[model samples]
Target: TTCWFAPGSGSSRGQGPPQQFNQVQTTYFTSIEILSDLYKKKVLIDDYLVDAYIDTGSKVNIISYEAAQNVTSSMEPSNVIMRGFGGLHAQSLGKVAFKLFIDDLHINSCAEITTKSNLGSIDLIIGQPTINHPDISLVTTSKSVTLLKNNISDNFLTEMQLSSTDFISKVTLFLSDDVELSPGAQCEVDVYTDHELDTSHVIVTQPKIFSLGNVSYFIPQAVLTKTPYRLQVVNLGVHSINWSANKLIIRAEVFACRYVLSVNI
Candidate 1:
């Protein structure tokens, strides 16, 4: 709530008064709805697990001085001032570099260091500098974001392109009966759900590593929501799978069109 500019810190440009130069942007929403709607993830900054907010609108990355201290004791001197909503301002201690780990992928990124009070509950704010990195690709659905290490292969890019085409939402799906599948064999299994559908067109995301050891399924097909909801499940393991009813917990993604078409008769 306090705002103070560094005294005798401005530098002269020409035949004019000393002007402040370095500055960075930050956004802190006062509304609970807006704050809750932002995409949040648990990431590792160096060795510390941090609850981070992903803000695509921001141009710079930010971290609290307390967090930076735990990660590293060194900081490059900076005159950068963080400006946010309601004319709130905080003078930066300095900038620090840290390794940001998202699952198996990690990126070396630099962020402006400020007081913990200035950051509130957020330990880190990942901005466009890291999100827009050449090796990083962020694919966002209706309620989630997929962070991919883009330098690996073209297949990841293709998958991202497909997922980005639809507004996807997840729902728990229940299997109707026990099923068995041989190695590399696939079939459409009927599923049960509690969600009342607003749209018939749904794209089911393939289930990741299931609890069943060495068993995997692929069901990336578009299906209509009917009485007996079915999804094509493939067994990608070396051995056959005799999955029991209600034993395998799978998530189904329902796609809704962002636009509605109307025609005049």
Candidate 2:
């Protein structure tokens, strides 16, 4: 449960939308209790509490201007220029010191930004940079973030491929049940070759699934890519299906250019 605001309104002038802007604008209703806190000078900003958005695509942390004014009366200005869906907008490039409580956990840091928009109902945009550390697990569906302190091992990468003639609506590839890897291990699955342009439009799931029968798969072509793609599997389903080992393992990394394959999924 997250809501999105386009960087610019319909009135701004520039290229339509920014690249990789995938969220819908409709308000997302959820029962999850949102947490808040304040950060400044590497310390908590007194009793200020703010709601945060767990955005996976956002590369930086952002705060509303109203929230900033409530926390402090005077502060240094920022020079960072942030561009959104519309185009370019000025964002103060100053460090943020805030406190946030997720469930019973409390965290204080000096890494945050203050913006001007109302941010709809969200006060903070907890982007990639903030969660880059291994401790943060920003689960969008659950509207919660889990912060762990211990380091975890990385998982082995897995790849997948589908036949061009197969009309399957969906496919899931699963890894071995005993092979425990890091939670964020990079998984690459090649659906088809460049020459087979028609088959390149396949969709791969994130956090590749490795469950029942020690395999998972996905179907229905979506996009084309020349190089091997690193996919992330986001969910797990019931345990009733098994996969065949003879299943094709499409080449991951492609070098020289080749002809396109014209088959439908």
**Which lDDT value does model 2 have at 16?**
15
Residue 12 of model 1 has an lDDT of: 24
lDDT of 2 by residue, 114-193 (tens): 44442556666666555564564433224334443333211111233445533443443333222222323333333322
Angstrom error at residue 96, model 2: 2.8
RMSD to native for every prediction?
18.1, 21.0
Q: Estimate, for each residue in 174-217, the C-alpha lDDT of model 1 and write its tens digit.
A: 77899999999988887776666655445354545453567665
Identify the candidate with maximal TM-score.
1
Q: lDDT scores for all predictions?
A: 0.64, 0.39
RMSD of 2: 21.0
